[model samples]
Structures are given as structure tokens and as C-alpha cells.
Target: MSKSLKAICAVAATTLLLGISAANAGKYNLGRKALPEEIKAWNTDVRPDGQGLPKGQGKVSDGETIYNEQCAACHGDFGEGKDRWPVLVGGKDTLKSDDPVKTIGSYWPYTSTIFDYVRRSMPFGNAQSLSANETYALTAYLLYMNEIIDDEKFVLSDKNFTSVRLPNEKNFTKDVRPDTPTQAQQKPCMKNCKTEVKITGRARVLDVTPDAKKE
Candidate 1:
């Protein structure tokens, strides 16, 4: 393509992206306001307290089928994870060890997060494809695989989602950081934080594997 043609194409692409941005942002005056349904499509986050959880239920058996067909490609048959994909189960007593295996059963604090994440951004490429029931079923299946729940027929739903808590639930504390921008977690650490300040630096590359006794 000629330079002028390429420039024209680039301008067109930029205009298109800006138009889209303006449409979604709802700030600029050029694009029309987003419809209520359109806004709702993006507002699908479920809170930790099951606030936004949709009414749906699924059994572990159903979850197993879905996992085998839709999830096992990357997360493995038993949530052991394949390649660099995240491991989803086990790691019960390894938190205090040299390497902490943070998985659904091991490190995640809430069951609602399981449901929310699965429904919102799971199954890899085909995100937001799973329904509420499917997500619930997968959550139940993961719970079964993690040995948190033994019954394969156990059903998970929004009604009892808050009741189901992970082993490390008590470990995760609420973020008390200030809402305003102060450049600190809560407040600026100006005084001596440690008894004796020691400058130590660690490499960024850390091979933290998700592994534990499956039996």
C-alpha cells in the first residue's frame, strides 16, 4: 500500500476506536448514551457477600461434565492445571512451607470469588460464555476436587454461596487503604518501619509452583 493510503487507513482506524471509546466512556458528547441493557452487560461483577450473584444452581456432576468438555484443556481433569495455566485445587498445608501453592482450595478466601471469576472470565478464550448455573456447577466441582466438599451431587448456588468458605478465608484481611490518593497502602511510611532497616532486594522471577499431596 502507498504511504498516503496507509495514513488514510490509520486515520480511519483511529477515528473508529475513538468513536467506540466515546461510546463506552459516556463522557464525550459525540456518541450516543449507552443503553441500560448495554451498561448492564458490563456490570456483571459479583461481590464477596453474594450481592450481585444471579439466581442459579448446579451440581458437581454437571460441573464435572462441563469441566471435562470446556475447562480440562488448560486446568486439567482434576484442576491440576496444564502448562502455565493456574492450578485450581489442593495445597492445603503448604502456605507456611518454602513455596506456597495458592489455589482455589488453598489460598482463595471466598467461594463467591470462584463463582464470579468463572462466570466473568473463565474457559480461556470464550469468556463470559458460561451461564450462572454452569459457573455454579464448575464451582461445586472445584470444591469437590479440592476435597472441601466430598459429595459429587452437592449443588452450589447464590443462596448458600456465602456459607461456603475456603481454608484460608481467615488469612485474607480487608484492605484498609485510604480511598484518596496518598501514595501509601494506608498512610505514608515515614518513620522507622523495622527495628533495624536493612536494604534487601530479591529477583522478580520466582517459580512458585502449585503442587501438593492429592491423596
Candidate 2:
């Protein structure tokens, strides 16, 4: 074959191969675009600013009733927690203690988080079962139990959801990794960098771990 003709044939072959590969890539139509209702159902997450909260109102008194019926089995009647379950109230100054008890009143940074979590995953096995109004009621009841709000008749709705703020909200700052020195820039020592090695303490001597050899 002529040199120019051979070069043209090679180029044509390469183009054909690339076209075949592109056609075969991800050829299987495994999934389709989600339906509007499906998208709405899965996109039920409420944001910290109450952006996705559903339109509904619930009173603290109503929440207490719903909580006692649906939630008291796991969480106590007043959000004190049952057995090894989570305690949702109190724990005011325990954050600095050795055994810090983090609770909804002391640890959570937003009221929306409380509403969102409970609305999505509460009542133990049955999740996403509470109506919008019921979730708001439960949120209000929790706030009242934590002494954040005093009124039993206080209605919680999307209109004023952002009005209630958690005490720890001020403690949480935005992630500033872009503005701060990275681990590589922090001069992390990877090799024998320490001048001297001293045994501060032994776990066996401190009885921190059980002596399995003694058995």
C-alpha cells in the first residue's frame, strides 16, 4: 500500500475504535430520573435556618401528649432518656467535666437540628411517621423541658422556627480550612523528631486495661 494511504487507513481505524469505545461506555441504562413526588419525599431534610420545614403549627401541650404516647418508651416522659437511650434535657455546664453529658439543651447548636432529627428518625422503629404539626409539637415540648421556653401553649411553626436558637450555636464556627494552615504546612514530624523518649505512664500499672494473662 502507498505510505499516505496506509497512514489514512490507520487514522480511520483509530477513529472507529474510539467511536466503538464511546458507544459502549456506560451503555446500560440502569436508572432513570427521579419522579417529582419521589424527589419531594427524599428531599425532606430541614436545614438549620428552617429552610425546608413544612408548613404546620404545634403546641407544647400537644407535643407532651404525643411524646408521652410515642416517645416516652425510649426517651423519658420529660426527655430525661430511658435506660441507655439519649438524654435530651439538661447537661448545662457538664461540657468541661471529665464525664461530660451532652444533651439537646447543652450540646446541640440549632433548634432546627432537633426538629429535623426527630421528624426524620424518632419513635424508634417507625421513622418519618410523625406529621409536620406533631414534629413541631415534640420540638416545642423538648424546648420547654430544657427550660428554653416557658409557655406550654407556645406554638412552633415554620414561620417562627428560626426564632428559637440553641445555646451552643455561638460556640460553633464555620470550617476555615482554606484560610488556615493545612496538616502538610503545620510541619508534622514523621520520623525520629523527639529529643528524648520518656514513659509517662503504663496502662497495666494504672489498671487502665484488664490483665488477660492473669486468667
Candidate 3:
């Protein structure tokens, strides 16, 4: 019956009510679980191990045909690229250059990535329109253009997908962040961070920012 006891009881009731509301937050029958078919439709991503590759086959010759028809407008006839579009083929040994040409041949780490990318999004405006066979053929053509595959008659499919590997595949190393030493582990330099500070460059002289007032 005391004022403090009444206040304490009211506070306890409010806390209990809030706990109950929080427990039943998402219990409303708003949305149903996605069907298997619905999930399959969106889960079209292919993996490095050729897990999601559909049952289909294609040759380099067939890929050239598909590439010319579907891909040549944006990417050139031989994947040289049109205007400022991405160049798909050639760029061997250019990774260390001042302006490196990162084509499928020189830079791509895996062959599966090429197939997956082309299958999912390619031909510029028209995306995801290629069949499994078309994707395989295009992938083959790109490999041939890159000189990875000697025989144009070579057929690429889910069976032999892993056999074809990119040249730069060996260059790529696994992320060693977990085992590698980090800067945080080193002793921090709180005082005298540097012996002397020098002006390396001037921002005004660099002219990195555009003269917006001129417009």
C-alpha cells in the first residue's frame, strides 16, 4: 500500500509487458517460406568446383558464333573490347605495367569465374539470356582467344570444367590474415612518430580537384 511499493510493482508490470511483446515480435503470419523452385531460380550461381554448372556442352567454334552474335557489339569480335568496354582476351604479361590491360587471359584467377560471370550477366543489355550450352561455348571461345586451349575443337562441359585453369591461378595466394602478423601486434610509437616531417607534395600543385567555379 506504500507509494514506493506501488511504484516498484508498476515498473515490474511494465518490464514484464515489454518482455512479452519482444518475445512475440515476428510471430505475425505475414510471409510464407520460399518454395524450392523459387530458391532454385535465384540460386543460379556457379562455383569454382563446378557445383552449380548445368548439364550442357559447347565448343570454341560454337562459342565464337555466340560471342559474335550476342557479345561482339560491346566486346569486340575477338574480345578486344569496344570503345571503353571491358577487353576479354589478350593482356598477357601486362599485370606489372604502368597501365595494365586486365583481360580474361592475363588477370582472371579461375576459369569457372568466367563461365559463371558470362552465364549470370553478359551480352551487355541482354543478361541471363544465354543457355547452359551457350555459356560453355562462350567460355571455350574466351579460353581459345587467351591461348589457354590449343584446340578450337575442344569441348567445355561440367565434366572437364576444373581441368582448365587460369595462368594467374598459381599467383593468387589464400588470405593469410588469420596466421599473418598484423600492425596491431607491433609496439605503438606514441612519441616522436617520425624523426622529421617533410612536405612530399603540394595538393594545389597536384591540381587533383577540378576548378568548379570555371563552369
Candidate 4:
């Protein structure tokens, strides 16, 4: 056979084998394996150690401008937050109060999370629209507003992302508590759950039932 014919036959065989395998595997032939690009698109998570930060840079000043244009309406001018919206600034020492003001500065543990979250989802209706630099700037701006960063000229980038930390970072420690396993893992008594169910109490005697006479 010709080289092209062999290639075509190989492809056809591979496809047929895959179809047969999938068909015999299970009752539900669902979604295919995720593509590398698809996984990469959703796998834009930046860790606390700044592992997955993209290559970009933004100054706090730039962040402020972007915030005002996109984030201010809901987040307020100074990140005070508008009506029913969450406050992103202040609440530095209100954590112990009866109503703790858990803003980004006071509550979030990692700075990288701020960048990651904003990049993944922000601008309310427009998520994942911010470029890497825009995300960096926004993060830098938030840091400044929260008093985490000292300068508006401070430029934020993936390289220096981990240097900045949230106030709550020191408060967060590794959870040493044991994990609770699901009840589904336990062996259930499917047969003869109980010897018998007896109604030992009378509802009428307990005055739980309505009176027979009309009120």
C-alpha cells in the first residue's frame, strides 16, 4: 500500500478502536478528555507561593485608574463598597468586633489569591477579561488601598508578587484537624434496619391533635 494509504488506514483503525472501546466501556458515552489548551485556560490558578503567576506588570496608579473605571461603581471610590456590595478596603482592626468587617485587606490570607481571583472572575459581568498586566495593577491597587503597599508607583508583577502579603497571612495556619469521611463510605444495614417501629406515644393525649368539636 502507498504511504498515504497506510497513514489513512492507521487513523481509521485508531478511530474505530477508540469508538469500540468507548462504546463497550460504559452505558454513558459522555465528554472526551480535556484538551491541553482547555485545561490551561481554566488552570490559571496562582498559588500562595506565586507559582502560576503570568508574566506581566502594573503600577498601583494604573490600578487605581482601572478600578475607578471598572470596579468603583460597586466597590466605591476608595474601596469602601457601595450599598449591599462588599468592602475591599479598611477594617484593619475590626476582626474581633461583633460584626467583623472582613475586607480584602483584613481577611484574605494570601496576596497571590487576590490576583488569581480578580483574573479568574471580576468586573461583575465581565470575567477573565483583564489582561495579566491589568490583573497585576488591580492587585497592586488593592494592596495600596488596603495599606499593604506603601507607594502608588509600586509596580506589581509575577516576579515580586509573593513579597507582598495580606495582614491575615500570619493568622492562617495549616489546619491539623482530621478530615471527616463521607457516610457513603460506611457499610449500611440495608436489610432489617430495625426489629420493629412502635408508636408508644399518643398525639391526642399530648394535645398535639386538633379537637374534634368545631371552635
* Candidate 4 lDDT, 1-215, residue by residue in tens: 99999999999999998987766675576656678999888889999998888899999999999999999999999999999898999988898999799988899998988888998889899999999999999999999999998987999987888888787978867887556654567887789999989999865565645665433
Model 4, residue 78: C-alpha shift (Å): 0.6
TM-score (C-alpha, index-matched) for candidate 2: 0.70
**Which residue pairs come into collision in candidate 1?**
none
Clashes of each: 0, 0, 0, 0
lDDT of 1: 0.85
Estimate candidate 3's RMSD in Å: 10.3
Compared with the true structure, the alpha-carbon lDDT of candidate 2 equals: 0.87
Worst 10 residues of 1 by lDDT: 206-215
Instruction: Please give, for residues 1-215, the per-residue lDDT of candidate 2 as tens digits.
Output: 99999999999999998877665655673455578999888888899877899999999999999988998888887677899999988899998999787888899988988888998888889989999999999999999999889987799989999999888888777787676566765778789989899999865665546554532
* Per-residue lDDT value at 215 in model 3: 23
TM-score computed on alpha carbons, candidate 1: 0.65
Residue-wise C-alpha lDDT for candidate 3, range 23-90, written one tens digit per residue: 65666734556789998888878888888888889999999988888888888888888999999888
Provide the lowest-lDDT 10-residue window in model 2. 206-215
Prediction 3 TM-score vs. true: 0.70
After TM-score superposition, the amount by which residue 47's alpha carbon in candidate 1 deviates from its true location, in angstroms, is 0.9
- Writing each residue's lDDT as its tens digit, candidate 1 over 1-215 gives 99999999999999999979966775555657768999788878888888888889999999999999999999888788899889897788999999888998999988878888888788889999998899989999999999888977799887888878788888977788776687755877778866876658633334344663333
Question: Which sections of candidate 2 miss by over 4 Å?
Answer: 1-31, 174-215
Best-fitting candidate, scored by lDDT: 4
Give me the runs in candidate 1 sitting further than 4 Å from their true place: 1-34, 174-215
